[model samples]
Target: MLTSAPPDDASPPVDAGRSRDAADARFEALARMARGHFGVSTALITQLDAGRQSILAGAGGSCGATLAELASCGQTIADAGMVVVADTRADQRLRDHPLVIDNPCLRFYARCPLLASSGGTLGAFCLFDDKPGELDDEQREFLRDLARLAAMAVESDSTAARLQEEADALRANEGRMALAIAGSGTGIWDRNLQTQEIHYSSGWKSILGYADDQVSNRIEDSYRRIHPDDLAYVQASMQAHFERKTPSYEVEHRIRCQDGSYKWISSRGKVVSRDSEGQPLRMIGTTTDISAMHAMSERLQQSVDLITCLTDEVPGLVFQYRRLPHGEAFFSYASAGIWDIYEVSPQQVASSAAAIDAIIHPDDREAYRASLDTSAASLTPWDLEYRVQLPRQGLRWRQGAARPRRLEDGSTLWHGFITDVTDRKRIEAELQEFATTDFLTQLPNRRHFMKHIEAELARIQRNDGGCAAVLMCDMDHFKAINDQWGHALGDLALRHVATILREQLRKTDMAGRVGGEEFAVVLSDADIPAAMAFARRVQQRLAATPLAEGDQRIALTISIGIAVMTASDASVDAALSRSDRALYRAKESGRNRIECL
Candidate 1:
């Protein structure tokens, strides 16, 4: 269906070696699907070359935006951001692109690069249209997310192909089941349990593809028609129902149809009359043509078999999440992968769906609930990334994606996968921290400290009666320590001082290494008196602690400055300046004391 060749003899297989493209039918279908969703004239998986670009899939339409004009793809690759130009003509860079100047000129463009796990950009998925276009934030996010999926498809082609094969097999089995159910026949039967007599309607004979005259009215005829293997089980079940152990008599068994082949029959009946002795005198039921039902059941068994196989082979938790109309959530099925991430087995989660939900980090639960509500309302796929708290492992990153279905009864079901993305998230966090954390003290660097200060300032603005304070700390005669001992001991001294700060500060208070041998703390909701007291505690603690090397101990001391945020203090910088001036006073008044302003 996605042949990249020309029609008839002129067509040739796509040149895969010359360009990087999915070159697969599935990928082509996905490209077209994206095109449909975007309502764009052209959508392509393209290999964006330095000077030229080649369409790998979809319509193979060329975009008018060239490198000299506005190489959106080039910019996307360089910045690693999804690029979108709502109106190319309005932008000077793109206004000169060929598409904007030519007939049937393209006016809108958007693209997300297909980045490989190796961190290399591998072409891109792009959309272009003749008319000006725009996309909302959610739509852009979806586009970028879809590009990630596309990258996976391209990278893991073999896995996708194997899944397709299994899907095809399942679909074929479904077709056969449907045919069997459609060609079924029904019959009627009644029996007098007390008299040991049986009666069969003409329809009952016709159900077996036989005339009424060919069948006997005796109960033996029914017994002889049942398959030997199914007779015992059918008889036991019906006996239980007749003895009042079950609510009704219903059983399925194979019976000989007229064409010499066995067909499945589901016989059902209930006792309409009872004797005075509290015993059933007679019972009647209808026999359904259930040959198709048996076939369908077998197909279902095969489906479960495949599901079990795939679930075990997959890398993440597979689950069927259901929410009933009455607001009850049930986890119908869960894979063994649940043990790896949640520290709980599949059976445990299945036993109670809330067990998994409850383990989500408390701070993340509200957003998770809101996402679920929105997805259920719009029947949209739920793609969420959040943190989960494991009893022993602390908090970890988890990404869940579910395809939702709404039932007639107002219940919702989601077939989804939840993967443990903790490793990736941790690496990302480390990379980000490396940029904003001081390597020596392992505290926030100057830039990161400013961000926290701004956030706390915003909190104060939002509060009706709020207060905050800043503490500036500097090591006294730190230069002499490095000169007397060595830089290694000086580093040790910094680490020791960092430890002291962490030990003395509350979790709500933030400490940062803003300069060499200089540190600062931002205390939320702290008054001037509290700030001054905290500074004195740190000054005393620093005076008591000493850094020891093999045979000698170096006395350690610090100068502290405190400044509380005031009504006239316009910014964090203003309060920080006041604290710095106070710190100067502490240093001037004989180095090892506290000063407040």
Candidate 2:
């Protein structure tokens, strides 16, 4: 809480000697009126802060309490500025009000706003009862009127001090102007035509980190703060300012602060007063911290240096391209690894975009175009890998990505980087091929097969004119071949059987290696009879194919089973189960036969 010294009672009374006397008399009358009307132990009139409506004065000890203690009463009474009675013993909202629950002395209370001369609520006048009671509306109105009169007297006392305050403010402005012109611990000089002597402020000595009393109040003494490199130019500027009536002077140079550290400060000043002969007389100005600005300038130069170094600094190709309306166009972007990736200089590729586009793999150009088209239409980011031809070398894979932003003219500009990703792309393709195809037969593996099954199931579900049939085929007598001609011969026989089956199936049918000796086929648009016929053809083809090894021709046979899939099947697992059951029955019936389930 901020506390101001209480006004002296003996200095001047409001009525007898000054306006305060009248204010006291007015407040005394208000207290009498409130006490008579409220019939309470004490009736007090108080003032409130203008910026804040919290009670600043009261009848007795209540005025001494900080605003935080009053809580809800402070907000309610201060804002509404009307008669409010919190009879805690009877009113539920205030039954547990802080004043009643915490300090039993305030069981009932009534307060009416004290109106300032401007008609703003300044504070209140009220009576507190130790027991619950209420004040009627008429009595409340009477107390409010009396409080208004008391507030008016307070305003009258404030009016008396207005002139003295204006005088004090004018004196403060003069001091500020003098100090500013003198400069804060900064040396300033003026020539007096009458004496031909220079005048400087105490700051002149302090600018050099010297005590004002220790240093002679001379212009040269203050010049000690200027860096030796800038002292000559600064001296010359001052000479020109005085000789030509330059009106103003400014310089950003190093200065010695109080702690003896060299800090950069810009001191600026303008002539505030001059003699009748057009000669400069007085000046005023300020010094500002420019260390941040200097640091930023230094960082900007460093960034330029870094960019200059990057032209030949890195290893991999670092090229940039901008997307244009016709297609993605290459500007004069740079790369350090242009020679390494494409056996060409960055200058050559930057100048000729058609030459760069010619390097894209013939098969991958359409894919690259589609990606660019999608990105341009949506204004979305794009990343793609495409093969580029290298001079006298094989193809190299390059990964290019661009971030596009829409311009005000409804055109898109893309900022993109191209990097050599041949090694990474090669590795990724190997991994993907390994994941999707069987190693031994080079056919679609289980993971890829399940993807096809799901697509076919979805198509059937959508009434897209296709029922899919899954044919599970197991090599017959494969263990016997391994037992007779060794595992190598048996492996050759399996490969031969897989090749024969693939050739026998239609182009629409997908064949996959599902297990050690088991294979699966997804036949599109093939119902139960069609699938059975296809399975029989695969069985007969496998039975006829002969696996050729070192010196032997091994004959192979396949037991085939087909399952026509329906939408009611919960998952691929259900379809595979049905196929497996059919395969089991096919094997039980006899080897080299086709069965449907």
Candidate 3:
């Protein structure tokens, strides 16, 4: 039945001499074409090994080199397609190669990679010469087309050999196969299905630590060693085979070893021939030790079960990630719970991880990609908390953590979890806002404003070269305006001042409503002159803008007091205190006037 169906791990048949001759003949035609078209001295088709290449065919001549000695094909192979180097000495990647530095002193080189169907680089078709040259777009494209044809030829040869191999393997003699199996540390058995008895080879008895004569050839003798829990399944398998339900008798079970412990084994067999009644007349099989495989499978099962339970009960997603060497990525596994968080199915993300990228908030996508690149570069764990936007859900914050590893083939894989942290983030933001930001103005309140000032001072002190200035502004006659217009318009007027502060100030500057009708600015790295200039600008802008309600327009003005963070001012409070006194002086001199201290 293995011949009736394709096997999972069958390799193609091989004939060293004849296959080599056929390969060389086929490639010689191609080598000739390449040499004629490119006018190169050497044209060869090669097979790449880990640290070397074997020249299969050539025009002009062919030779081999250790990869360390000259890996002239390396660049083309890595690129996985055509590469043209105009001058070998000008190419840094190939400049120091022995072939370039010494003999022939080859100057021109162009090669196209022979790609395998499985996406691995096999080797290259190369053209080399002493004269420097370059290819135009049409010539480069022509080389790629030739490489594709070469790949098709390789695949055709392999497929024919594989078919022949399967036919031969199907007819391999049972006695010879059994003898071979025994030599390879496997056990063989022959069974009479009608008699319900089996003859086991000496190797089978040895596997269980039984003396050859101590074990009987009877099937019941084998039954005694099988684990009790496997008895019913074994009986069922035999019955199904008798009914012809399965193609063969293949089962995995634990058998009691001689020391009274179990060892997992895989039994594979087929009915060799059938009687006139269509019953199985004879069956032969081989047993392979699978204790290590069983243990690993059990551990894997535990992990799967754990994730399944969490997918149903937990509020998040879990996944296994695969990233190929060429930057293509997919999710090998994703929990169904992702649908709730991302409004996308596990299958969708599994098929293409780009679907997840599409839903991530646009503002955060660059950061997300950057984090992955950085993590891959450093081989560090990736940890990110970022916002994602959904059409229905609006914006939400998600926390993600993944451990990344580089695989042998140069790809990277990550095992990660993503959880909905929106509620927690919201709570944290509220708490922080209440502590530092003014409820009415939505600007930093007094406490946080002072903290900002403290930080700026620390930065200025460390750098020891930047300037700083502070401005104190109070609504002119704010108490009288509140008395006449009521607290509502008074509140509106305060908001008006806060808006100007936000719209006019640079991002580097910080402004806060430090108290009722009192606003302040901390200009980082601003000198006394810059501070006065800013104060004058605010004076001009506010004088021109006014607040209106129900056809009533009220003109407004603010008096500003400015002070610089000079070398003598050790603390933010000292600058603030000076600005406050300056404001008092400004109020006494004239309302709407700018005063500096």
Candidate 4:
């Protein structure tokens, strides 16, 4: 029901063949104006030939039934020259029509006829729809007026055949162009700035999940279909183009379909023509899919940014090198931290092979060269650890590992990791010291002493060296001292004994406090008599000093047992057991004494 039930006089009369093109152009303009007032896809100017008496001048999708059919039904208003379809199915004449059956999607249509100057019916201006609907009297009169204007344009042509020829040619070209655009997978749109009218191709409507016939004149309809997040940006770009600031523009945006899902599209557009004053008259645009491309670009940028940040922030020298065409090494990547770690800038490292070679310790230079030679000759990975002499930082260790890559020109490329291992090397040395020495006394502990004893035995066996002795000393009444003076004074006495023993021992001997109140000393190059003499000296020293606690004098005695291991001694355990037996005997004989095995 798209037709108006208005009086015929409401619309102006038409003249024939005077200004056909001008009249049709006016019809197009009137449609553009009426779009804002009453939203519709388009208002068209059509003419049926003289033989087609029923629909000669006008046509509408729903109400433009055959003239004989409408006449039989008494539904036509010749005076007003308008046809309306309140509801396509409800109208008996149109329910079984071919348009209704063929295009089940369309449910409404309306049209108004225009008069020729010769008082003959020529053509009509029409509005079409896929919906069945009613139009009020006011809407009907407005549509009738639009039809009258369209009729004037058509009849102004010199002959009806000429007018019809132009229409046929225009439609043929438009049809071919529409097919091409649809196949190209591009959405096309035309916007008229002066009239605020939009002409969207079928492909464009398909992108938005709508039939081309369903489009409305309102621009807000297009805006609402765009994704909410992308709406502002699209609007801003459009405004900028409207201001004549940009001649052409491109933007990536998201568009929402009828069911409310969004797809990423790349929009590209150009302003085709401008007013005489240089303002934009119309713009044309197309949209293409770019979601996958944008995603890959973003991922690549993230990876590059991550690598850049990590290399800049990490400590120590990091170098990667590849072999050049000739057998020379050339740096590919080096971090800024190389300057801090090597006291040599990356620039110096990359300047020449001799520059890096000069920094290597003399002892390691030849070995490093051999390693590189081996790597270049074979496909195996290169891994080497060595020391370097920094200009000011003394000797530092570095570890390098690389894999060989054969390039297109038969040249080899070595990508590798180089890190300063100085701090790790220092920590390892400290750990080895801590493992062997007693933390409190700074003397070799029981474990280290045993190891040294075994070494001495091997030395004596191999070289027929003289025997050494193990001196075991036990403090007398040491527990009683702790009870009387508290453990602090007892600690002081133990330290005193340790100091005296150290002063008494030769540089070749090793000493350690193995247990509470007990100390052992190994005389590496001393025989039995010499060991006995040394033990007696330790005993005498222990007795001579009476350790004091705040004027409370405490006399202390020590028992010493010396086990002498001959050059032929088989095991250290036997020697240690013999020392224990002698020590018990010395305690029994009298506290301040030394006994030998």
Q: How close is candidate 4 to the true structure, as a TM-score?
A: 0.44
User: If the candidates were sorted by their TM-score against the true structure, best first, what order would they fall in?
Assistant: 1, 3, 2, 4
- Ten residues in a row with the worst lDDT in model 4? 53-62
lDDT of 4 by residue, 97-177 (tens): 555555565465566666765677665655555566678987886676555555555544433355356547777475666
Order of candidate numbers by lDDT, starting with the best: 3, 1, 4, 2
Residues 279-322, model 2: lDDT tens digits? 76665555554554465356446655676478456665555555
lDDT of the candidates, in the order given: 0.74, 0.65, 0.75, 0.68
Among these predictions, the greatest lDDT belongs to: 3
Minimum summed lDDT over a 10-residue window in model 1 is located at: 68-77
Give candidate 4's error at residue 415 in angstroms: 2.3
Error of 3 at 588 (Å): 2.8
Candidate 3 Cα errors over 4 Å, as ranges: 1-310, 323-328, 349-354, 357-381, 389-395, 403-413, 454-468, 481-486, 500-508, 523-557
TM-score of each prediction: 0.48, 0.46, 0.48, 0.44
Best by TM-score: 1
Mark the regions of model 4 whose C-alpha exceeds 4 Å error after superposition: 1-309, 322-330, 353-397, 405-413, 462-466, 504-508, 536-557
